[model samples]
Target: MTVTELLDRAHALGSDPRNTNFAGGNASAKGVERDPVTGGDVELMWVKGSGGDLGTLTAEGLAVLRLDRLRAMADTYPGVEREDEMVAAFDFCLHGKGGAAPSIDTAMHGLVDAVHVDHLHPDSGIAIATAQDGPELTARIFGDRVLWVSWRRPGFQLGLDIAALKEANPQAIGCVLGGHGITAWGETSQECQANSLEIIRTAARYIEEHGRPEPFGPVIHEPLDEVARRERAAALFPLVRGLCSTDVRQVGHYTDSPEVLDFLSRAEHPRLAALGTSCPDHFLRTKVAPLVVDLPPEASLEEVTERLRVLHAAYREEYAAYYARHAVESSPAMRGADPAIVLVPGVGMFSFGKDKQTARVAGEFYVNAINVMRGAEAVSVYAPIPESEKFRIEYWELEEAKLRRLPRPKPLAGRVALVTGGGSGIGAATARRLAAEGACVVVADRDLGSAEKVAAELGARAHRPSDVAVAAAVDVTSEEQVVAAVRQAVLAFGGLDLVVNNAGLSLSRALLETTVDDWNLQHDVMARGSFLVSREAARVLLAQDLGGDIVYISSKNAVFAGPNNVAYGAAKADQAHQVRLLAAELGAHGIRVNGVNPDGVVRGSGIFASGWGANRAAVYGVEEEKLGEFYAQRTLLKREVLPEHIAAAVFALTGGDLSLTTGLHIPVDAGVAAAFLR
Candidate 1:
């Protein structure tokens, strides 16, 4: 088409409601298409793909590609990658259809060969056309420069029309159909873009001046008490469905705000006919403008019917006209014949949809739009895309296609864990296992050097020393400390999804021999320390809204209080109780708390001191070897439990994919505690 013809068509199309399909039409190119003016092969074209708002077309939405290769690749790769891949393969996919996968509209673009194509649904265009002034307005805008075609269903027929137009006017920039978006092309990509923008801007301006919106008077609704409102919200599904005559199963009711009340209460509810969404795609969620009403509490079913009749009639009339103007003879009947609408009582509006999910999504969007409109009112005008324009983009096939793309990931593509006693033994073992399972670990211990060494061995997946017993050391213990540590962990490794509270201490003493100082020291390091660390861990888990596992290193002493271990046994028993308490308190917050009680853990564990070896030997009236053998023989497993065994228990508790068992105290004592009668 000639440049002037294209420009005229763009202008006409910009004002046509049917021209814009759901989700808006997108026009893109790859390789070089000859420019009408410059006759140069520099490749460029504007694509309507990125902008989320169908009503407004911005430069950012336009995806530019090499023209020659884009068309050819599309013909070649029918079912290849979608958007990004198509763009990436553009350079190599030249010539005939090779191994490339092209966009669905590749054939259409190749057929039109237009430098610039614009698509949108203009609501005012549809609203005005219910009568005859619509065509008259078209004539006034284009004069002789534009070629107008009768409305046709998009796809083959539309493509044919463009082909004919191109044949008729070799220098034509673009074309416009009665009920569709406009198309404009020029020798340069910029010119085509500018032409499209100018046409739409001009049409918007005309609508603002000629099609003035009616004023709505302030509506007054009965004030509702907070208790009543909350009760109403609790039964929101039934209430909202009753209001809008649609499902509300998935819909959530927000507390009624002043804006919602005011919007719902307007006396002269402005007709949405002129501001319908641009296309049918939007109808998937937003059926149509919500029906605004003010019904009395005593209103009868008949009264409600009468109000609905008025609103439905208006909507049906507008919809019929739109269909008649745009639908092809072969097109199927529109489903859900009635457009969705909102119903407002004395205050607040409810959105309607075919299903609950749709209704809820539409309601949320409506609320957001209301907020935006209210904010805009404070600054300037609260202008939204015409309803028809919104409809067109909502229904656009290309726009819908774009939404199917998945998101990408980051470099640290793994889980993260925090180990409380990661400085050595069971804590260190657990940290190492977590790292092996593709997790970055934060090793915290009272011994800073030990923590650093463990962290170094684990490479980049470890944390420094953190004392679980000290209030200030294990930040998870103190609110401030926990907040800081959690924040640091999140900042460093992105997030903390696991915590192993294995930091603890034990002292062996007879009941009478256990002094107050000894009891306090053991309690502080074991029971209090676990409490502090677990508290911090709970805080982090709650803050992140993550359900995490916490494994406390308790002991078999928790169940069997042995002689010469009064202080240690008591502390361990208290630790088990703490776990249960934490589990109960944090269950609602998705935090799982549990404990591991193990006995006879040899192999360099602090539980077995050099002095204990000799002391136990003396008690048994046997040598060290004999005492060790006797201790081992007492267990059902008939084996000495090692530090690694305890580590394994720690691993089982914190690991994901395990059963969600909280407040549990699993014995890792080889059944020895059961053998010893209390």
Candidate 2:
């Protein structure tokens, strides 16, 4: 089969989460290609390369190696002790320029005698693979056709072992790699795929047939209803995330999926979860084991939080000990003492990583682990690879090398942001800019549809395009709505780090013409709105104990004394001073509060466009359309400020460059000398 068909096959297998976790599987095909050097045909193998997900495999992600050279190198094999060197040797076996770095699994697919090969970590197959009696169980389930290969760390030696087993068991279509996953081979890509599916299906059926009821024991703690479970998760995430981030900042993901809730509520959860995940892929992402905190479903938030604080510290100490116990001089420095996965019996799972996609995927992998443990316990006692071996894999030099290959993090990589009024104007611009710098963004606005559109666009540009941004609806004036919006941000990406209070409304009226309703509406939307948003977010920020940011999109009228703008100007002045007041009160907590005063954010501003533009233009004796130019010409710099300009100023206020500069106001009015802070 052609290499194109191989990629199609790889995508099919990876697309099914049942077959593998994210980036977990590898596939290959042996084929003939024309050699430019000899002007003749040569044998080559195309396999999925390092750091590539099978679901999204592309031509560029395939490593092409010459079979003759790869086979020849086997003769000089330095055995298992120097198997790491064999990974480097694959570089030499590369054909021509080589498409991508060959993964360690390259040997497993390459050395096999079959023309087509697949090495997958399907949940059902891994359930049997990691079972206590995996070898005997394999014989019972698939009989002799599925050979059982004992556990061996993945390397060139393991590849050779599989190849030797295949040669001896001539009739076997595939093998179950003990304490790991599954592998299958065939003469064609379709046949290989079929054999892989058959093994997975048969193993799954066998487990179902022979499994006992209540494999995890009866549920001792039933999950809370959906809303209450989410509320508990939301309440606990920031504190837990903060604990995880003591050494390094982390992005978090929360999931209350049925499988997760089911697993957490079972009686055997603590025992099985503590035993840890079996597959290296799952273990690598989830760490050695999860941190489980069990409390009654009706427990008070205060009690639950207090319990978490105690447990979190113990978890860190234990994790540090785990690192100390197994580390060698050559092992990579301990990555962190933080647990990747945290389980609350009534809630669901909270997973942490360096970014949103990583965090989300990490949690998803643990769900796969849960499934693995359940399946294994159904028929056989759950048995993972030993702790020492897990330590070796966790700190492997090769994995460290892969990590080093990643680009350095962006300035706001792990920070979370909530941009109010993000559907349009400065808020939207700020959301885009922050997301571009790697912050997880919550685009919140009164217009749900508009917010959703912005979030969709933001996610498309993100590294993994999954959880980088989300939309939330908020009127800001309503305390309930504001709190919910902030909670949405916390539930989405752990907790808050940046908040832009930009939602506002205005009406330009002379003192005599303005009604109290006009005054109250403007004040309620801008002044009271900013206060509620700030107050609710502050709860999470204080809980995190990590420094955070609060930016107010105040107006130049706060200091400019603009005409026929009494209500609007008064509200702006209130917002501007709130920045100073909050900064002073919160400085000890490291919560920096700042304001941006823009005179002419007229072009794209929602406040300006909704009739406020025409009234203000009338007051100044200029046409509404030319108001931006009029305002610009009035400025000392004679420049027109756009939404992007305001966004940049917002970024400057909290974007590390001005970390120590709080209780400050930066104008984005293209140099409005009259609106100087002093």
Candidate 3:
């Protein structure tokens, strides 16, 4: 098949999570390419590169290597002890710069002799791979079609062993790398994909037919109902997230799928989880093991939290011991003692990472582990690779080098932020800035569609990893909505680190024109709403003990008594006080509350377009279009204020530079002397 066709095939196979997980597999096709210098057809192979996920892989994600050169290296092989050196050797053999760096599995693809190859970590396939009697199971399931090879950590030598077996058994289409995963090869891309599927399906069918029932043992505790489950997660998430962030701040992901809940409820789960995941990909993301709470479903929240604190401390101590036991002097310094995966019997799992996507993927890897355990135990004991072997992979200098290759994180990296009124005006601008600065963002607004658009734009444009931007529909004036929106942040991103209270509206009216309803409505949305949002956010801020930011979007109207703005001005005045009030109360927790007072934001403003601009324009006897210029003329600088300017002020208050500064207001009003704080 052509190289283009091979990529299509790769996309088809990788699209299904059942076939393989995020970045858990590799695929390659051997073809003839015209050499740049000689202008002669040369045999070359294109394989998925290091750290590229097959599902989203592009031509650029493939490594191109000349077959002759790659094959020549085996003759000078330094053997298994120096097998890692072979990875460096592959660069000299590249057909070009190659699209991306060759992955560790490059040798396996190049040396296997087949025209096409697929190395996958399918859950069902790994179930057979990790089974205690994996060889016998492989023989029983696919007979001669699939061969079984004993586990060897992946590198140049494992490729040689697989190639040697393929040479000896010409009838074998593939081999299962015991305690690893599966591999298959064919003369063409289509044949290779089919053979891979054949093995996965046949093994899955074998387990389905012969596997024992209730393989994980009967449920030891029933799962909590959905409502209670979420409540518990909400209550405990900040606490758990805070513990994890002591070393490095992290975002979080919560999963309560039926299978996960069922697995957690089973009696055998803790024992199997403690043994840890078998796949290197799984173990690396989930860590050596998870922290499984010993408490049952019936425990009170207070009781459970108290016990969890002890368990967390114990987990760290045990993790430190594990590191010390396995690490040599040259090993990469301990990454962290925090457990990526956390399991509560009644609840499900909470996975954490430096960003939202990492936490989510880590949880997915653990789920794959659970599936592998289920399939393995159905037939025999679930046996993972030795801890020493896992340690080798975890602390390998190659892996450390990969980490060092990553681009440096932006200033707000690892922080989670929620922006109210993010649909338009200052809120949207602030959301974009924070995301660009590397924060995982949540755009909340009364207009769900508007929030989603801003969220989508920010999510796409921001490339720094570990982020997952989302949108939530919230009317900040409603306490229920406010609480729910804050909870959504905690659940989506582990915890909240920054809050921008930017949801607002204004109406200009004389005392006679302003009704009681106008006064209360404005007050409800700004004054009371700010209080509600701050109170709810403080719970998480205090729970995390991570210190946070709460930036208020007040107005110059709060300080300058403008004509026909009595209701709107008074409400903003109330919001202004909340910044100082909350700062005084939350300072001990490291949360800095601040405000940005802008004179007038005309362009791209939801409030202005919704008639506040025309109302104020009439009050000043100026055309609506000239109102912005009119305000600018009145200011000392004669320049109009903008959303971005206000947003920058918000960032300056909390973006690390102002860590020691709080209970302060920054004026973003193009020099409005009358509104200056005195």
Tens-digit per-residue lDDT, 324-394, candidate 1: 65555543445433445454454344454332233434554454334333322322233344445444444
Please report the TM-score between candidate 1 and the true structure: 0.40
| Model 3 Cα lDDT, one tens digit per residue, 1-678 | 467877987898888977898888999999997898999999999999999888888899999899999999999998898999999998988887638989899999999989999999998999999999999989988889899999998899999999999999999999999998899999988899999999888888888899999889998889999999999999999999998777898888999988799998998988998999988889989998999999998899998899889999999999999888999988999999998999988888999887777888899999999989999999889999999888999999989988998889888988989999999989999998998888888899999999999998887743323255789999998999999999988888888999999999988899899999999999999998888888999999999999999999999888899888899999999999998998998898899999989987899899999999999899889999998999899989999998999888877886788899989988888999889899
lDDT of each: 0.52, 0.90, 0.90
TM-score of 3: 0.97
lDDT (Cα, 0-100) at 464 in candidate 2: 64
Put down candidate 2 lDDT per residue, 565-624, tens digits, no spaces.
Answer: 899999999999999999999999999999999877888888888999999889889999
TM-score of each: 0.40, 0.98, 0.97
Off by over 4 Å in 2: 462-466
Alpha-carbon shift of residue 260 in model 2 (angstroms): 1.8
Better of 1 and 3 by TM-score: 3
